[model samples]
Target: MANSDSGASSNNYSFKVVLLGEGCVGKTSVVLRYVEDKFNERHLTTLQASFLNKKLNIAGRRINLAIWDTAGQERFHALGPIYYRMSNGAILVYDITDEDSFQKVKNWVKELKKMLGSDICLVIAGNKIDLEKQRNVPIEEAEEYAKTVGAKHFQTSAKLNKGIEEMFLDLSQRMIERAQENDLQKASELGRSSSMRRNVVVVDDEQAAETSTSKLTCCGSTT
Candidate 1:
């Protein structure tokens, strides 16, 4: 992808991004807010996974982001690794008003690092920012955690549409830059174990997408 300020030089890029957290953290709402610019107040649990294909023009590059929303129930927890397989990026979401959710997000960050390693563009989202009065996760605390984990943090409100755009855009831009720098290949080699090749998420797909726009999993293809 091109950086307007840095001089435009780019190609079509596609990335797989997964949303993760405890149930009711507004993972679904965040993705909907980005792709449809809408929010649902009534809670709906996602089963397995649901995805959206969003195309963006950033710095004159056509970037395709295949965003996945996964179920966060304890029973569904085992499916997380499957959903996150081969993901280029991940957003660890937590309800700002729920302290447990915040803790869960931290646990998830650790799990993701173990699974996807340091190559992924990790993001921390303090969702439900509209309910500032009910906030349980302090902004400073969250920002500090993000820094510790080397993740970019954002306070977002899917209902109010705050910080959602910038968060996703930043992830996309960084992903593009990583592809351009061939950083992902290095990251993948470092993270992947030869024994777990089949268990790994779609790392090859994302790497393949570095060249072919059509090779991207436009919707859901965790494995």
Candidate 2:
């Protein structure tokens, strides 16, 4: 979700991203590690859905990410769209040790593409690379799937903080580029429409706000 409330005068580009996966795939762990730089040894459960706000300065752009962590239990599967709908990007996590979890990620990829179309950015994270000795999903297979679906694949470990930063950074940059392209297309369409009509039409300036670089901040909440 782009910041619908932001005006043309603002400089913040807000994007909503959702995390999806099976239980114990470490979706919340990944978010906590990236946003708060903290990791918990104990297992955590997300009830329905919760979101954390992360502010990032990527290539001189102030990107505000509302990273949503949703429950991965089968009971909560029905509520997936409520959290993911209108989201700009998605991180589908799967424990490398669990082959079933990887299958679940594929299901989500199909559902997201069917509902949101190809415009939504996707990242398939084979998490818990630290447990490589017990890995069940092959790295090459996962990469191939991601490539076929037009999504990026990564190996991430919240415990060791491996690949967390790089994955989010890559996703953020992708979203920014997509948003800019959308704005340009909208501007072009508006220009053509204006040329066709001689009368001046009042329009809401829905373009993205001005952007600037900023440091990441630990600001977030759970719902």
Candidate 3:
């Protein structure tokens, strides 16, 4: 899974990260910035979930991110759980300029936790950071909510690409560490199972040897 060309030992860690929030919250914009390093100003509402891929190296681990941009309208909410299930992590986005969008973050978090479990890594991203004059959700308030839910918080401007890469990079590092920890746990369990099997085989061999020796001794004594 390591990328040989990067000169650093890179393991290809496939991680799914979904964006959830109310409509027009710049979910797709944030994803496009992270995946393509480009931004579009004419915002279009997302109909279905859109997927994008990006590769990066974090602490020598090659992480491949599968970004899912889900439609935030109420009608499309039924598909929300399906997207959440496939995600190892999530970036819950809200427009900094819109209070209603920001308020819906709690709902998104609730649904995600209900479907994906509390262990799933979640990041609360306050989008449109560039629109400071129109900002309705204060940074402090948004960050406090993020802390309350145990999710990382970021203020990003997709149009400006500010904090976009950093957010994804942070997620990548966390995902890589999680994957490594899980791998180590599995390896340790396998090693223990193998050792137990070996011990059983050795005990059986010793018991068989003792039985053979006992039979020989009996025969010799009788003769």
Candidate 4:
């Protein structure tokens, strides 16, 4: 388990992740729980969006995560793709007690795929899981849908803080891994570029030396 709040370092990497789902499904609540570790019973619905910055360590490397909590109303859905464009990962959430909200998870996924591509890292959350008595979406069904869309699924209770930390931690870890791999690839590319530049410099130096030697020989013959 990596520390979630370690400060960034020279070896640290950062990435952006966004949360998308139907309105009132507790996307803001989940992010508030994960980033602040506090819940507000009277929090207002998110309007445009909110941003939170968190640091995480994965496999001994520090990584920074910028989380975007997006508004989920149908009217706000138009803005979802912009967030998706800049995100390296996403969390799709829905209310467990609302069948319509649960169904909208598929729509969110579809939009994300259409805009961001299928390989985007994603987690599917069934929120308000504490209201099991009122659950209109079955656990198996949600799990199946998550699997179908290749997203990780979890049941969470933002009110009780159940599964809240775990969900974000899991998503953070996945994002960290992706960031680490990306950093490694970039470092390799830079190394190759540097080596190629050095080779070019060496070749230029050799050519310059040859040209100087030829000039000297021609002057000597003329003299």
Candidate 5:
């Protein structure tokens, strides 16, 4: 088989993805839904920011995703660049019931583009589908904005655990493809080897257990 000749050609990719939205809009809930595979109705408002790390093996490539959840309060807005700098992707989330949150998501997308340029894999998520009856942001309108900004839009419900995985998986896959393209471009420009470095994998037993049971939070400071 032609696949046999490919051997075990595996490259590991570590991607940083930030979740940006207003407080009480379920940004933390969405992160927990993806990383812990559980939902909490009484989740406290996140003060500053935190992150969670998950590893996935896709087509012999190990993708280590660090999902950062940022505080959407305007006071903490200044700290955004601290987390999103060097990020490979970002998910601009908004509450379906809160029109204001959608507006905030728009501002975020604009800022990200101005600062990070067009390469940051972007996605817009209209969250809280479980409360669809209360939705104030129309799906068509959000989809149109997403298309205008060159990003994919998804309707998600952290409470019901809908569309959470698909959003993350799609973003991760896109990041991988983008990385491959950049690698190819650099190789052509520099006339250097097109090979990628091996990604070191390490996980301690206690850390792994904690990640499963504890809140999905990671690298960032509290306000």
Candidate 6:
């Protein structure tokens, strides 16, 4: 990928992803499992929203993921835009045992689409699969909804560390492909005749932050 104002380098890419869902849906647990490879038996409530960084080398490309875990409580819902406004992707998590949480994920999907449009990649995760016996959301139903929304679906068990790694990796790959396509489009446009050329500055909240540090600064947050 060509280096641009968006903080993408020749071999390095930085992407910001946010977790959205209702409280106690294991959003924090999912992030912890992917970024730290650890899980907390006791539930931890997020205050507002915080992010953590994970570095990966896939096919000789350096990918840096800034995963933002937001507070899912109803009271903090109004602050969601602050965290996800310029994110590259999103992970909508819901507990398999909670039907209401699944519905909440739909609401989040609508909000994200309305704000960020289809440019943002999305992944829908039905978490807490360890309690499969207590599952209220059927796998087929979730998968169908994900397909309808152009999002990939996964059944994740954060406690057991199942599907978490694959979920992040899949989302990252999708983001990388999207970014590369965008870069190609920009290059093609710039190659056009000089008569159509125009100067414009592209500025974004997340882009400015990413440009400050390659792959973004590493940070840690508990759920």
Q: Of the candidates shown, which would achieve the greatest lDDT relative to the real structure? A: 2
Q: Write the per-residue lDDT of candidate 5 for residues 1-223, one digit (tens) a residue.
A: 0011111233778888989888778889998989999898896687789999988988778888888999888899999999888888999989999999999898999999998897799999999999989999999999999999999999999999999999999998888877777766655755433232234457899989898655534432321
Error of 4 at 85 (Å): 1.4
Candidate 1 residue-wise lDDT, 111-184, digit = tens: 98897787788899999988999988889999999999999999999999999999998999888776766644
Ranking 4 against 6 by lDDT, winner: 6
Selected candidate, larger lDDT, 3 vs 5: 5
Regions of candidate 5 where Cα sits further than 4 Å from its true position: 1-10, 192-223
Over 28-105, each residue of candidate 2 has an lDDT whose tens digit, in order, gives 999999999999999999999999999998766678899999999999999998999999999999999999999999
Backbone clash total for model 5 is: 1
lDDT of 4 by residue, 1-223 (tens): 1222322234565667788888889999988888788788885599978899987765777668888999987888777767767577888889999999888888878888887675478899999987899989999998998898888998998889998778877877776665556556667899999989888844588899999999999999999
Candidate 2 residue runs with Cα over 4 Å from true position: 1-11, 199-223
Badly placed stretches (over 4 Å) of model 3 are 1-10, 195-223
TM-score of each: 0.77, 0.85, 0.81, 0.76, 0.81, 0.84
Instruction: Assess candidate 6 and give its lDDT.
Output: 0.88
User: Which pairs of residues collide in candidate 3?
Assistant: 1-12, 2-10
Clash number for each model = 5, 0, 2, 0, 1, 0
Mark the 10 consecutive residues where model 3 has the least summed lDDT: 1-10
For model 6, the stretches where C-alpha displacement exceeds 4 angstroms are 1-9, 193-223
Measured by TM-score, the strongest candidate is 2
Mind giving the per-residue lDDT tens digits that candidate 3 earns over 109-217? 8887887675578899999888999999989999998999989999999888899888988877776665666666667899999989888844588899999999999
Candidate 4, overall lDDT? 0.80
For model 5, give the 10-residue run with minimal summed lDDT.
1-10
